[model samples]
Target: MLLEALTHTWPWYIAGPLIGLFVPLLQLVGDKQLGISGNLRHLCSALLPRRIDFLRYDWRGAGAWNLIFALGTLLGGWIGVHLLGTGEIAISPDTQASLHALGVHDLSGLVPHEIISWEGLLTVRGFVSVVAGGFLVGFGTAYAGGCTSGHAISGLSNFQLRSLFAVLGFFAGGLLATHLLLPLLF
Candidate 1:
């Protein structure tokens, strides 16, 4: 029963409140901003040893725990897939219908192999969605000063106006992608 629970999804009502609690917990424990994207800077600082202004900080002092968090995320994902995964994945009927309408036939994998594989990557649809979309995500995250998780969770918790604007922009972009760009590509 425990293993079954581990392999299954959590109800949003339960999961959402737990995730929401993280912000206050983090604030109480340490006055640190919770964001995954900022860890990249700390990593670059350690590896490059450059004299760049942004990279000049004592990354270990400030972001050692963040790096550990990143490591744990990676490890947890591996453990989940290898030790706890049930091989079958669950998707909503509406999502499956939408994908079908978009010409996706395979629903066996986490992502449609027809659109995400090496061969599929050379196709225009795959190239645009995977490569170009990835670039846009990275660029947008930097331009906004943080990722969606940061803005929606930590920044909002601290009542930052910039984060509110960033979250709105994120919603707009996602709406645009889902309603327009995604249909055009797929």
Candidate 2:
């Protein structure tokens, strides 16, 4: 079941690659792909941004399918946590030991909890970070002519070497941010 998969086996490394696989399959079937970064354009359209791009696409021409999909995602996530079970992934000792090397131990902020609840996964600080990060990601995706998923999934599937490079950059940027920058900021 989806709930079991989420609760028992979901991790970024696992989900990311599986999703990277799924996106291309969807693209092959629908001729369209998925990415979270583009949602900023939706938010921008909702806010009447200086650049009204999401509106120009006429997503409504899809008969509000986008809206339905949005609702489904939200509903599905809630069901996963509430109906199936709550998530509390235990961080690996390797991660904690690495944090130890970074002068972070069990200390607050400097060190993170080993086990994280779904809500704890989205603390106020985390939420703010998501908002700011989302904004930056939106800008980057727009500038890149496609988001990470588009590049890693749709573009890469066609053997576009550029997508491979972009994916590498994405991984590099994430490592730099999480390992180096985030600790400094927090």
Q: Please report, as a residue range, the 10-residue window in candidate 1 with the lowest summed lDDT.
A: 80-89
**What lDDT score is found at residue 57 in candidate 2?**
61
Residues 64-99 of candidate 1: C-alpha lDDT, one tens digit per residue? 988998898899778877787747667889989998
Indicate the residue-level lDDT of 119 in model 2.
Answer: 51
Model 2 spans with C-alpha error above 4 angstroms: 1-7, 10-21, 24-29, 49-55, 62-64, 100-128
lDDT of each: 0.83, 0.63
lDDT of 2 by residue, 40-136 (tens): 5555555565555544564454424445555678898787667766544466778777767764445343224431334534665455456767667
| Candidate 1 lDDT score relative to the true structure | 0.83
Highest-scoring model, TM-score: 1
lDDT of 2 at 123: 65
